[model samples]
Target: MTYFVYILETMNNKTLKYNLLVKQFKNNIYTYSLYMLRNRMDADDATQEVLIRIWNNIDKFNYSAAKSYIMRITHNLCIDFLRKRNLLINRELEITEDIEESFGDESTESNPYLVMQMKIATQKIKEAIEKLPENLKSVFVLYEMQGMKYIEISKALEIPINNVKVNLFRARKKLQEELKIYESE
Candidate 1:
Protein backbone atom coordinates (compact mmCIF):
# COMPACT_ATOMS: atom_id res chain seq x y z
CA MET A 1 0.00 0.00 0.00
CA THR A 2 2.85 2.43 0.74
CA TYR A 3 4.49 1.60 -2.60
CA PHE A 4 1.26 2.37 -4.44
CA VAL A 5 0.95 5.73 -2.69
CA TYR A 6 4.55 6.61 -3.54
CA ILE A 7 4.00 5.75 -7.20
CA LEU A 8 0.87 7.90 -7.38
CA GLU A 9 2.60 10.86 -5.79
CA THR A 10 5.56 10.54 -8.13
CA MET A 11 3.30 10.38 -11.16
CA ASN A 12 1.35 13.41 -9.96
CA ASN A 13 4.56 15.39 -9.51
CA LYS A 14 5.69 14.57 -13.03
CA THR A 15 2.33 15.60 -14.46
CA LEU A 16 2.46 18.91 -12.63
CA LYS A 17 6.00 19.58 -13.76
CA TYR A 18 5.12 18.86 -17.37
CA ASN A 19 2.11 21.14 -17.25
CA LEU A 20 4.22 23.99 -15.92
CA LEU A 21 6.91 23.55 -18.57
CA VAL A 22 4.33 23.45 -21.34
CA LYS A 23 2.77 26.68 -20.16
CA GLN A 24 6.12 28.40 -20.00
CA PHE A 25 7.50 27.22 -23.35
CA LYS A 26 4.44 26.85 -25.53
CA ASN A 27 4.40 30.24 -27.30
CA ASN A 28 8.10 30.40 -27.94
CA ILE A 29 8.10 26.86 -29.32
CA TYR A 30 5.18 27.50 -31.62
CA THR A 31 6.52 30.81 -32.93
CA TYR A 32 10.04 29.56 -33.50
CA SER A 33 8.81 26.43 -35.23
CA LEU A 34 6.55 28.44 -37.49
CA TYR A 35 9.31 30.92 -38.32
CA MET A 36 11.71 28.17 -39.35
CA LEU A 37 9.31 25.92 -41.24
CA ARG A 38 7.54 28.82 -43.07
CA ASN A 39 4.50 26.68 -43.76
CA ARG A 40 1.52 26.09 -41.51
CA MET A 41 1.47 22.35 -42.02
CA ASP A 42 5.19 21.80 -41.41
CA ALA A 43 5.14 24.22 -38.49
CA ASP A 44 2.25 22.35 -36.93
CA ASP A 45 4.12 19.07 -37.18
CA ALA A 46 7.27 20.63 -35.80
CA THR A 47 5.36 22.17 -32.89
CA GLN A 48 3.88 18.81 -31.96
CA GLU A 49 7.25 17.12 -32.15
CA VAL A 50 8.90 19.82 -30.05
CA LEU A 51 6.24 19.66 -27.37
CA ILE A 52 6.46 15.88 -27.15
CA ARG A 53 10.24 15.96 -26.90
CA ILE A 54 10.15 18.61 -24.22
CA TRP A 55 7.50 16.81 -22.24
CA ASN A 56 9.22 13.43 -22.29
CA ASN A 57 12.62 14.90 -21.58
CA ILE A 58 11.65 17.69 -19.20
CA ASP A 59 13.76 16.12 -16.49
CA LYS A 60 16.86 16.74 -18.55
CA PHE A 61 16.03 20.44 -18.87
CA ASN A 62 17.68 22.78 -16.43
CA TYR A 63 15.23 25.21 -14.89
CA SER A 64 17.78 27.99 -14.65
CA ALA A 65 18.40 27.86 -18.43
CA ALA A 66 15.14 26.51 -19.75
CA LYS A 67 14.38 28.96 -22.55
CA SER A 68 17.71 28.58 -24.30
CA TYR A 69 17.54 24.81 -24.09
CA ILE A 70 14.09 24.62 -25.61
CA MET A 71 14.99 27.07 -28.34
CA ARG A 72 18.09 25.05 -29.22
CA ILE A 73 15.99 21.94 -29.56
CA THR A 74 13.52 23.78 -31.78
CA HIS A 75 16.25 25.25 -33.91
CA ASN A 76 17.95 21.88 -34.41
CA LEU A 77 14.68 20.18 -35.19
CA CYS A 78 13.83 22.84 -37.78
CA ILE A 79 17.20 22.46 -39.44
CA ASP A 80 16.83 18.71 -39.54
CA PHE A 81 13.36 18.92 -40.99
CA LEU A 82 14.55 21.37 -43.60
CA ARG A 83 17.49 19.16 -44.51
CA LYS A 84 15.40 16.01 -44.77
CA ARG A 85 12.76 17.73 -46.88
CA ASN A 86 15.15 19.86 -48.94
CA LEU A 87 12.62 22.63 -48.50
CA LEU A 88 14.75 25.69 -47.83
CA ILE A 89 13.92 27.72 -50.91
CA ASN A 90 17.11 29.70 -51.18
CA ARG A 91 16.50 33.41 -51.99
CA GLU A 92 13.15 32.74 -53.63
CA LEU A 93 11.72 36.28 -53.06
CA GLU A 94 8.20 34.88 -53.36
CA ILE A 95 6.30 37.42 -51.21
CA THR A 96 4.60 40.24 -53.09
CA GLU A 97 4.44 43.73 -51.60
CA ASP A 98 0.97 44.11 -53.02
CA ILE A 99 -0.25 41.49 -50.58
CA GLU A 100 0.97 43.55 -47.65
CA GLU A 101 -0.37 46.76 -49.16
CA SER A 102 -3.84 45.34 -49.27
CA PHE A 103 -3.74 44.89 -45.53
CA GLY A 104 -2.19 48.25 -44.68
CA ASP A 105 -3.14 50.28 -41.65
CA GLU A 106 -4.88 53.69 -41.90
CA SER A 107 -2.03 55.60 -43.50
CA THR A 108 -2.96 54.56 -47.01
CA GLU A 109 -6.64 55.44 -46.77
CA SER A 110 -6.21 58.94 -48.21
CA ASN A 111 -4.48 58.05 -51.49
CA PRO A 112 -4.93 54.90 -53.55
CA TYR A 113 -2.00 55.81 -55.80
CA LEU A 114 0.23 56.25 -52.79
CA VAL A 115 -0.88 52.85 -51.58
CA MET A 116 0.11 51.31 -54.93
CA GLN A 117 3.53 52.89 -54.70
CA MET A 118 3.85 51.74 -51.14
CA LYS A 119 2.98 48.22 -52.19
CA ILE A 120 5.69 48.27 -54.82
CA ALA A 121 8.14 49.56 -52.24
CA THR A 122 7.15 46.85 -49.80
CA GLN A 123 7.53 44.18 -52.45
CA LYS A 124 11.03 45.40 -53.14
CA ILE A 125 11.82 45.22 -49.44
CA LYS A 126 10.55 41.65 -49.31
CA GLU A 127 12.74 40.70 -52.29
CA ALA A 128 15.80 42.24 -50.68
CA ILE A 129 15.19 40.37 -47.42
CA GLU A 130 14.84 37.15 -49.41
CA LYS A 131 18.21 37.84 -51.01
CA LEU A 132 20.04 38.01 -47.67
CA PRO A 133 22.37 35.25 -46.51
CA GLU A 134 20.70 32.40 -44.62
CA ASN A 135 21.92 33.52 -41.21
CA LEU A 136 21.01 37.14 -41.77
CA LYS A 137 17.69 36.16 -43.27
CA SER A 138 16.74 34.09 -40.26
CA VAL A 139 17.60 36.90 -37.91
CA PHE A 140 15.62 39.42 -39.90
CA VAL A 141 12.63 37.14 -40.18
CA LEU A 142 12.59 36.39 -36.48
CA TYR A 143 13.24 39.90 -35.25
CA GLU A 144 11.29 41.96 -37.75
CA MET A 145 8.43 39.85 -39.06
CA GLN A 146 7.92 37.55 -36.09
CA GLY A 147 8.69 40.24 -33.48
CA MET A 148 11.22 38.24 -31.53
CA LYS A 149 13.77 40.07 -29.43
CA TYR A 150 17.52 40.13 -30.09
CA ILE A 151 18.12 38.05 -26.98
CA GLU A 152 15.73 35.34 -28.11
CA ILE A 153 17.30 35.25 -31.56
CA SER A 154 20.76 35.13 -30.05
CA LYS A 155 19.75 32.29 -27.79
CA ALA A 156 18.08 30.34 -30.58
CA LEU A 157 21.01 30.73 -32.98
CA GLU A 158 23.61 30.36 -30.26
CA ILE A 159 25.20 33.49 -31.66
CA PRO A 160 26.36 36.59 -29.90
CA ILE A 161 23.98 39.52 -29.44
CA ASN A 162 26.49 41.68 -31.30
CA ASN A 163 26.35 39.34 -34.25
CA VAL A 164 22.58 39.49 -34.26
CA LYS A 165 22.74 43.29 -34.23
CA VAL A 166 25.30 43.38 -37.03
CA ASN A 167 23.39 40.97 -39.23
CA LEU A 168 20.16 42.82 -38.64
CA PHE A 169 21.89 46.12 -39.39
CA ARG A 170 23.27 44.78 -42.65
CA ALA A 171 19.93 43.31 -43.58
CA ARG A 172 18.17 46.64 -43.10
CA LYS A 173 20.84 48.53 -44.99
CA LYS A 174 20.77 46.15 -47.91
CA LEU A 175 16.99 46.23 -47.98
CA GLN A 176 16.88 50.02 -47.93
CA GLU A 177 19.41 50.21 -50.75
CA GLU A 178 17.30 47.83 -52.76
CA LEU A 179 14.21 49.87 -52.08
CA LYS A 180 16.07 53.01 -53.18
CA ILE A 181 16.80 51.40 -56.50
CA TYR A 182 13.14 50.49 -56.85
CA GLU A 183 12.08 54.06 -56.06
CA SER A 184 14.60 55.50 -58.54
CA GLU A 185 13.08 53.34 -61.23
Candidate 2:
Protein backbone atom coordinates (compact mmCIF):
# COMPACT_ATOMS: atom_id res chain seq x y z
CA MET A 1 0.00 0.00 0.00
CA THR A 2 2.82 2.44 0.94
CA TYR A 3 4.76 1.67 -2.27
CA PHE A 4 1.71 2.26 -4.45
CA VAL A 5 0.98 5.59 -2.78
CA TYR A 6 4.59 6.78 -3.37
CA ILE A 7 4.41 5.77 -7.02
CA LEU A 8 1.15 7.65 -7.46
CA GLU A 9 2.60 10.75 -5.89
CA THR A 10 5.65 10.59 -8.18
CA MET A 11 3.52 10.21 -11.26
CA ASN A 12 1.34 13.15 -10.24
CA ASN A 13 4.43 15.28 -9.67
CA LYS A 14 5.81 14.43 -13.12
CA THR A 15 2.54 15.26 -14.82
CA LEU A 16 2.30 18.55 -12.92
CA LYS A 17 5.82 19.50 -13.93
CA TYR A 18 5.20 18.63 -17.58
CA ASN A 19 2.00 20.68 -17.61
CA LEU A 20 3.88 23.67 -16.26
CA LEU A 21 6.54 23.26 -18.89
CA VAL A 22 3.96 23.10 -21.64
CA LYS A 23 2.28 26.25 -20.36
CA GLN A 24 5.58 28.07 -20.24
CA PHE A 25 6.39 27.46 -23.91
CA LYS A 26 2.93 27.27 -25.48
CA ASN A 27 2.85 30.81 -26.87
CA ASN A 28 6.38 30.60 -28.16
CA ILE A 29 5.61 27.36 -29.93
CA TYR A 30 2.41 28.72 -31.43
CA THR A 31 4.09 31.91 -32.58
CA TYR A 32 6.88 29.90 -34.17
CA SER A 33 4.34 27.74 -35.91
CA LEU A 34 2.43 30.76 -37.14
CA TYR A 35 5.53 32.35 -38.60
CA MET A 36 6.74 29.12 -40.16
CA LEU A 37 3.41 27.98 -41.55
CA ARG A 38 2.13 31.53 -42.32
CA ASN A 39 -1.48 30.60 -41.57
CA ARG A 40 -3.48 30.70 -38.34
CA MET A 41 -5.28 27.38 -38.89
CA ASP A 42 -2.14 25.52 -39.89
CA ALA A 43 -0.20 27.08 -37.04
CA ASP A 44 -2.88 25.96 -34.59
CA ASP A 45 -2.79 22.45 -36.01
CA ALA A 46 1.01 22.29 -35.90
CA THR A 47 1.09 23.55 -32.33
CA GLN A 48 -1.43 20.93 -31.26
CA GLU A 49 0.56 18.18 -32.93
CA VAL A 50 3.82 19.36 -31.37
CA LEU A 51 2.32 19.52 -27.87
CA ILE A 52 0.84 16.05 -28.22
CA ARG A 53 4.24 14.70 -29.22
CA ILE A 54 5.84 16.45 -26.27
CA TRP A 55 3.39 14.86 -23.86
CA ASN A 56 3.91 11.44 -25.36
CA ASN A 57 7.68 11.75 -25.07
CA ILE A 58 7.67 13.33 -21.60
CA ASP A 59 8.99 10.22 -19.91
CA LYS A 60 12.18 10.28 -21.95
CA PHE A 61 12.68 14.04 -21.64
CA ASN A 62 15.27 15.86 -19.60
CA TYR A 63 14.09 19.21 -18.25
CA SER A 64 17.21 21.16 -19.18
CA ALA A 65 17.15 20.06 -22.81
CA ALA A 66 13.37 20.19 -23.19
CA LYS A 67 13.20 23.56 -24.92
CA SER A 68 15.60 22.68 -27.73
CA TYR A 69 13.94 19.31 -28.07
CA ILE A 70 10.50 20.87 -28.37
CA MET A 71 11.72 23.42 -30.91
CA ARG A 72 13.46 20.75 -32.93
CA ILE A 73 10.24 18.80 -33.02
CA THR A 74 8.40 21.93 -34.14
CA HIS A 75 10.89 22.68 -36.91
CA ASN A 76 10.74 19.13 -38.18
CA LEU A 77 6.96 19.06 -38.19
CA CYS A 78 6.73 22.40 -40.00
CA ILE A 79 9.15 21.18 -42.66
CA ASP A 80 7.25 17.94 -43.00
CA PHE A 81 4.01 19.86 -43.45
CA LEU A 82 5.64 21.89 -46.20
CA ARG A 83 7.12 18.85 -47.93
CA LYS A 84 3.85 16.95 -47.93
CA ARG A 85 2.30 19.83 -49.85
CA ASN A 86 4.91 19.25 -52.61
CA LEU A 87 5.40 22.96 -53.22
CA LEU A 88 4.94 26.45 -51.81
CA ILE A 89 2.24 27.21 -54.38
CA ASN A 90 -0.29 25.59 -52.07
CA ARG A 91 0.81 27.66 -49.05
CA GLU A 92 -1.07 30.86 -48.46
CA LEU A 93 0.41 33.80 -46.58
CA GLU A 94 -1.64 35.06 -43.63
CA ILE A 95 -1.86 38.83 -44.17
CA THR A 96 -2.44 39.79 -40.56
CA GLU A 97 0.73 41.34 -39.24
CA ASP A 98 1.91 41.09 -35.64
CA ILE A 99 3.53 44.52 -35.93
CA GLU A 100 2.92 45.22 -32.28
CA GLU A 101 6.09 43.29 -31.67
CA SER A 102 8.59 46.13 -31.98
CA PHE A 103 11.73 45.30 -33.89
CA GLY A 104 14.21 47.86 -32.51
CA ASP A 105 13.39 51.23 -34.16
CA GLU A 106 10.06 50.18 -35.68
CA SER A 107 7.11 51.48 -33.67
CA THR A 108 3.41 50.70 -33.67
CA GLU A 109 1.93 53.99 -32.52
CA SER A 110 -1.22 56.15 -32.71
CA ASN A 111 0.02 58.69 -35.27
CA PRO A 112 -1.91 58.20 -38.50
CA TYR A 113 1.05 58.71 -40.82
CA LEU A 114 3.29 56.60 -38.66
CA VAL A 115 0.67 53.88 -38.40
CA MET A 116 0.09 53.86 -42.14
CA GLN A 117 3.77 53.83 -42.86
CA MET A 118 4.31 51.07 -40.36
CA LYS A 119 1.56 48.99 -41.92
CA ILE A 120 3.09 49.36 -45.36
CA ALA A 121 6.53 48.55 -44.04
CA THR A 122 5.17 45.57 -42.15
CA GLN A 123 3.55 44.24 -45.29
CA LYS A 124 6.76 44.61 -47.23
CA ILE A 125 8.71 42.90 -44.48
CA LYS A 126 6.26 40.04 -44.40
CA GLU A 127 6.57 39.62 -48.12
CA ALA A 128 10.32 39.68 -47.84
CA ILE A 129 10.32 37.03 -45.14
CA GLU A 130 7.96 34.88 -47.12
CA LYS A 131 10.17 35.10 -50.17
CA LEU A 132 13.20 33.86 -48.32
CA PRO A 133 14.50 30.36 -48.91
CA GLU A 134 13.49 27.84 -46.31
CA ASN A 135 16.93 27.65 -44.70
CA LEU A 136 17.27 31.41 -44.41
CA LYS A 137 13.66 31.97 -43.36
CA SER A 138 13.79 29.39 -40.59
CA VAL A 139 17.02 30.81 -39.26
CA PHE A 140 15.73 34.37 -39.48
CA VAL A 141 12.38 33.59 -37.86
CA LEU A 142 13.90 31.58 -35.03
CA TYR A 143 16.76 33.92 -34.22
CA GLU A 144 15.32 37.35 -35.04
CA MET A 145 11.55 36.99 -34.68
CA GLN A 146 11.16 34.17 -32.18
CA GLY A 147 13.99 35.53 -30.01
CA MET A 148 15.93 32.31 -29.91
CA LYS A 149 19.63 32.66 -29.25
CA TYR A 150 22.04 31.54 -31.92
CA ILE A 151 23.03 28.51 -29.91
CA GLU A 152 19.41 27.62 -29.24
CA ILE A 153 18.62 27.96 -32.95
CA SER A 154 21.64 25.88 -33.88
CA LYS A 155 20.49 23.14 -31.57
CA ALA A 156 16.90 23.38 -32.74
CA LEU A 157 17.85 23.34 -36.44
CA GLU A 158 20.83 21.02 -36.04
CA ILE A 159 23.07 23.48 -37.82
CA PRO A 160 26.37 25.02 -36.84
CA ILE A 161 26.28 28.34 -35.02
CA ASN A 162 28.31 29.95 -37.77
CA ASN A 163 25.78 28.76 -40.31
CA VAL A 164 22.98 30.31 -38.28
CA LYS A 165 24.86 33.62 -38.22
CA VAL A 166 25.56 33.51 -41.94
CA ASN A 167 21.99 32.64 -42.83
CA LEU A 168 20.62 35.38 -40.60
CA PHE A 169 22.99 37.86 -42.16
CA ARG A 170 21.85 36.81 -45.60
CA ALA A 171 18.18 36.93 -44.62
CA ARG A 172 18.56 40.49 -43.34
CA LYS A 173 20.43 41.61 -46.42
CA LYS A 174 17.78 40.17 -48.67
CA LEU A 175 15.03 41.87 -46.70
CA GLN A 176 16.83 45.18 -46.94
CA GLU A 177 17.07 44.81 -50.67
CA GLU A 178 13.47 43.74 -51.05
CA LEU A 179 12.07 46.56 -48.91
CA LYS A 180 14.41 49.31 -50.01
CA ILE A 181 11.54 51.23 -51.60
CA TYR A 182 9.80 51.45 -48.23
CA GLU A 183 12.70 53.31 -46.64
CA SER A 184 11.88 56.71 -45.13
CA GLU A 185 12.88 59.79 -47.07
Top lDDT model: 2
Each candidate: what lDDT?
0.71, 0.77
lDDT of 2 by residue, 97-185 (tens): 45544432444336667776767767778867876778888898887877889898999999999999999999999878767745653
Question: Ten residues in a row with the worst lDDT in model 1?
Answer: 1-10
Clashing pairs in 2: none
Candidate 1, residues 43-66, lDDT tens digits: the string is 678878988998788666565556
Candidate 1, superposed: residue stretches over 4 Å from native: 1-12, 90-133, 141-152, 174-185
Off by more than 4 A, model 2: 1-12, 97-109, 181-185
Error of 2 at 132 (Å): 1.3
User: Each candidate's TM vs. the true structure?
Assistant: 0.61, 0.77
| Clash pairs, model 1 backbone | none
RMSD of 1: 8.0
